[model samples]
Target chain A: MVIFGIDLVLLISALMISATPVLLAAIGEAVVEKSGVLNLGVEGMMITGAVIGFIFAVNTQTPIYGFICAAIAGALLSVMFAVLTQYIMSNQVATGLGLTMVGLGLSALIGKPYEGIKSPTLSKIEIPILSDIPVLGPMIFSHDAIVYFSVILVATVAFVISKTRIGLVLRAVGENQEAAHALGYKVVRIRFLAIMFGGATAGIGGAYISLARVPQWTEGMTAGAGWIALALVVFASWKPWRVLLGAYLFGGITVLQLNLQAIGVAIPVEILSMSPYLVTIVVLVGISLFGHHTAPGSLARPFHASQ
Target chain B: MKFKSVLSGVLLAFGFGTVAFAADVKVGFVYVGPVGDYGWTYEHNEGRLAVEEHFGDRVETIYQESVAYGADAERVINTMAMQGADLIFTTSFGYMDPTISAAKKFPNVKFEHATGFKLADNVSTYSGRFYEGRAIQGHIAGKMTKTNKIGYIGSYPIPEVVRGINSAYLHAKKVNPDVEFNIIWIYTWFDPAKEADAAKALIDQGADVILQHTDSTAPQAAAQQAGNVISFGQASDMADYKPFPRVSSIIDDWAPYYIARTQAVLDGTWESTATWDGIGPGMVSIGEITDAVPADVKAEALAMRDAIANGTYHPFTGPIKKQDGSDWLAAGETADDGTLLGMKFYVEGLTGKVPE
Candidate 1:
């Protein structure tokens, strides 16, 4: 029942729940990078989603609407990044950093009135037959709908990236923008779509924090989850399945560290505090290296087509 | 975040540059967390607002929130002083050395650092004895908890937080011999999602009563979700949870001190001082006790609160041993301000060591 003085069931359940927000954001970032763009404003977009989702959820009293609007808000914010990089040819790094600053400021402004307000938290859904199982059922099947959605989203994204024609074109664009443009693949359009998808996913990820994880609205509540999600994309080597693995690994180590601390283990708190990031980087990056995974060639490079 | 702050600092310098000339005096506030946290920073902002309202056009107040400690804090304080702030309040314990260093640089400018011990000619320190109020919550929790487990969410390993934990645990153990404490050091002053996760982890670990020394209402939301758990509001009265989770709170009132200090600066009588007040001086007032607390427990809690306020009872009254079983306080003896301020060791029954 207990592993290392922690209830294994509770630890696993907490791990899944804790990882959902970051996993969702990472999935979106993975897509964005795979299309040869890096929008560092993931933090900005996330808080925008967090505040917008929280506002709508509180006003309408429907968390689903909150998620819907949050994605729109996130994508809409990311559209700034899309427009600048695609048409204006602004430097992606500076623009992405600006977007984060803008997002934090804008969210604080809009979220002022909604501070300390609780959202309509989603109830856990226990799968009918699976809930009857002993340990794994309770661990994996009893989280809110968002948790399950994130997992399925990862699988769907992985399938699309590896199997679909759309995936080939996006990868081609990331690998060599000029080539993809010469091939008449409409490189700008594909990257635009990818950035928007990333924004939408990151937005939903931000919403998860406000609507379920914290279940309350607070200024800067997304904190640095967006940044971690951004890092997660590179560490996972832009692979969707690997992003999920990285999230769970980070989440699991964190939960384990806290649980062990609660049980009076005398491990230095500083070492344990930094363990999740350390383990996540070591495991995910180590795997990516062995698999020969690397960043997109055109990532963060400004691209424009000449007639 | 640093970029954002730097940009705002420029904007603030320009905006307040004009107002400073017309104003009789300029005052500044430096906060460790966002002003909208609805907790510690919120209360301090309320004090800042009160100063603005009380002084009207004669005084001008400016503040920068969510400022990091160390170099960033020193920079913010230095910026305010350079921009002509006559008095500035740096409201975070981590900003002690920065406050001292900044004060040295700007001798005429008055600086007050909260919950810190260091002092200089121009820098003073002030804090409330929140541990006095924690005793009442401890008694109520000991009586209310069915699980005999109390989870304390501690922010950082500072003496202010450690003292609260020790005082609360000592009282709880006095009432319930079976009571056990689980302490989690989160290392952040305000991060809602992380705070929520910590609260959930504590609940899942069998804690039924929670107390948070951090500045956020996220823990209240977490306890509310757990349905049966009880919690005390921290730094600010999180009244939304009301009769259930947030039964009582220790509210920090800094307005009067801020006003008096500002007045002292204006009057040219400002001197370096250390002020530590508790319920006795009304700086740390206890929030209302909801009916959710059993009548007997509520009465007992209130009685303890009054005794503490009246100075007849001390939360750390004697016969206590250090976690290592060494003598800490002898029978009929109470903790001195010196020992309480630098508290680093846990009492005998606590399970964990004070992290460095």
Candidate 2:
């Protein structure tokens, strides 16, 4: 049950919980990148989602409704990025960065009234029959609805991106927008939808933190997790499944390191503290490198149908 | 209206506006966390607000919040200096070196860095003796833990945090010799999610009492979710979660000190100084001990609080050994200010070395 002073079951459970937010954010970002749009405002949108979701949760006393509103809030903020980059034809990098700044400032203003307020929490759903198993059940089958939702999201995104007709058009648009346009595919429209999806998931991710993880509202509480999700997207090489891997790996190490420290295993706190980021990036980057996964060709490129 | 505007502009050009501006003292504040954190930075901001309220138009305060540590801190300090700030307060331990470096370049501009030991001719250090509070929390945690495991969420390995750890451990060990401390160095002062996770890990590991040295009520939230676990608030009165998870709190009262320091500046008597104040001076006050704590334990904790405030009992009194079991203080001898300020080792009973 315990190895190296760490309870494996508790450690994995914590990993699942911690990884959900980043998994949601990265998976959404992977889709946006696949459509050749790099909306760099994940931090902004996520925080906006965190505060909005927290506000809704506090008001409605229902975690589910808070999540829905949080997703909508994230997507709505992303629409700002979508407009400037897609319709007005502004630079995607600059526009995304601006969105992040806007999101941070806006969320701080909106969350002022909600500070120190406890949010309604999402209870864990232990799957029947499977949750009865000895070690595996408690570790994997027992988690909140959002945790399972995150895994299913990765699977669904993977299925849609690789095995569906929609996936092919998305790839075509990201690889070469002009070619996709010449072939009568709606490049801008497809990218817009992808940006919205990314925003929605990011919103859910932020909501998860406020509603479940910390279950309290504090300004800048998302605290750069959005930025970490942004990094995971690139490291995963625009793959939905790899995003899950990177998030779990990052979360797992983070929890493991803390547990190890708690149990009095001194492994150089500096190295241990940084191991989550270093190990996750190394392993994810290694997989992407060996797997020959490159980013979408038109990533961060503004598409103009007029040449 | 144009003629009236011209007449007013001409009157203002006659040095009336300039006369008022000459008396204005520009003060700057640099915060390590969002001012809305409702903890460390929030309390510091309360002090800044007090300065504004006390002086009104004679003093103008501008603050830059959420400034990152290290190189980012240097740039923020430089910007404040370039903006003609007469006095700047860098309110975080991580801003130590940056504050010192900035003070050197802007010698005329006074600097105050919190919870750091480094000083220059122009740069001063000031901090609350929060360890005095940790000692009380330690007593409650030690006596109340059914599991006998006390979980600590430490932000960094700085002397201030280290002092708190030692003071808490010594007090806890005194009350209950079987008590065990599970210390987690989170390396961050204000990350809510990590703070929550650390609290959960401690709880899952059978820790019934949690004490956080970090900002935010996430740990208290985590403790509340776990049902049986109890926690103490740090740097602020997190009274929202009272009577259960948040049994008590260490409220950082910085308003009085802020007023005193600002007055010193206005009186043309401002000098580089180091201030390490505690409950005696009201810089660190314990919040109401809730019903969760036993009546006897609560009374004892308050007695200790009074003893500490009146200088009869020092938290770091003698008969203590270092983490390595070496002599740190002899019987009846209190720890000197210099050793406490530069504390880098744990006390005798606390497990694990202080991470530098």
Candidate 3:
């Protein structure tokens, strides 16, 4: 079936790929913000992950190893931000911005040698019976493993954040770190672990761009995707499920715009290009009107044990 | 802030002092995208390298890549001017206004912008006539394709890109009356993922031959993966995909122009002027036509290329009509540079409006 001259199956497929990376990065950032840490370096962490992930995948001939290295590289880079903001009590916003700069610069330096080199791409995991299902199979089950992993990761994060003992402690710390500390929870340590998780997930997101999406490494390939993920977190109102919806919404509009252009739409290309951001802003505004626009209590505030 | 400004003042003084010393000429380049893109910026970076190789120590060239083309571009250009750059090349269309403003700030520093119309006393606007190459590509795409449908992934609705789409469509329709052009305007200069997705969408709609204006090899790669498809490279020669999908490419050769401009600065012959060179002047080049193309088609394409080079043919010749069916070019009357430079409408027989 075709809608507005765009084929339904192809549109769904395009939406899945476009939304995967942004979803991965946003879900990771949602966790970071949930821990009372506002790490603005998601862009940085994602790009570094993309380069390192490409290098390893190309060398090891396996995307699994590449994603592992990407996560490690992203986590290591986030550690620097963690030390500055968590321990040294530097400004989170400034440090996060600096981390992004360092990430972009360092990734450019590291990725310089990998230019023009083609890395192996990840193939989709198709289940025989399920894949044969009309419409949904090709749209859902036909994507690479990372697409499934991102959804599962979001579900797992949502479950762990709401149902687990650790979830309670993380929520307590994010609500009021001093109170969590009084309850014998190590606020800084928990926040540190949360930040590292964010870095790793963001790395995987970046690796997804290099290893599967475009399946090649180019400098700054993340291309402001990290920023979009950051916005998605706020747009999702820090909920994992909401993050998934928001990412798909973003991906859908992006894919739809391209399809609209291909189908000979007479609207200006600039208007179509702005449709994704425009719809996103409108949705965010609608959510705000519904009074769900609140951030973590200590989102960007540095906590000191004695103070 | 006071201390920083004081320090900058001192540095500015020193920068001027170094310029006065003048033992070597320092040329700076501000690129809108990363040099690793293997497309527009990559070719410009190559031109910068050519400058270094040609002049050695007599000229020192430096560049900052991936600069955004708005306020950030203005600031970057200003910083380069303040750092005592003898001549700076701001290589992107969006850098036009910033380059002019920066040139106004530093009257001593010469500036050159790519694919822009605006110029100042110290600023020159230059671009390649890439449509000449597109005409050849159109001929090839017309001759090719078991599916009679060709796809074009446009970067923006700018006149330059519009000219290319028009040239390709006009020439393709000339060779094959049944051919159809599917154009997708992707409003970005260098996003590979978006470019690739556009390519896939086009191919899904039965486009067997693809053309792109964006700076990425992703579309070529997409065409390769989709087998039985043909594509052409843009900005740089992506010969890696040769013998199949990447049959030929439009190469942006900026080295000779760069070297000559630098030489002009050295000899005190530098003056702000507009330059729009094509295949004839070697600014726009067509990469190797591989054996994948049938001998007759290849010969015809090369002949068209040579004709453009020798000024025997024009891409936007008369007998063209606007998308509205209004007369744009009368038969046998070629388009002048002014109309082509400010082109904002699609030609007749092409679908969709060129977005304002």
Residue-wise C-alpha lDDT for candidate 2, range B138-246, written one tens digit per residue: 8998999999999999999988899998999899999999999999999899999999999998888889999999988889889999999999989999888898889
Give one clash count per candidate, in the order shown: 0, 0, 2
TM-score for candidate 3: 0.95
Task: Give the range where candidate 3 chain A is weakest over 10 consecutive residues by summed lDDT.
Answer: A112-121
**Candidate 2, B319: how far from true, in Å?**
0.7
Which docking category, incorrect, acceptable, medium or high, applies to candidate 3?
medium
Instruction: List pairs with backbone clashes in candidate 1.
Output: none
Q: Which ten residues in a row have the lowest lDDT in candidate 3 chain B?
A: B17-26
DockQ of candidate 1 is: 0.68
Off by over 4 Å in 3: B1-23
How would you encode candidate 1's per-residue C-alpha lDDT over A1-307 as one tens digit per residue? 7876788999999899889889999999898998999899999999999999999999999898999999999999999999998899999999999999999999999998898676887878999999878988898888888899999999999998899998889899999999999999988898999999999998999999999888888888887899999888877878899899889988788878777766668888878778997897678657766887879998888788883
Candidate with best TM-score: 2
Model 2 ranges with Cα > 4 A deviation: B1-23
Candidate 1, B234: how far from true, in Å? Answer: 0.4
For B1-356, candidate 3 gives per-residue lDDT tens digits of 99999999999999998777654788999998888888899999999999999998789888998888789999998898887799999998888888888888899999999999998899998999999999999999999878899999998789999999999998999999999988898878888778888898898888999999998788887888788899998999987778778999999999999999999999999998999999999999999998989999999999999999999999988888898989988988999999999998888899887777
Model 2: per-residue Cα lDDT at residue B50: 93
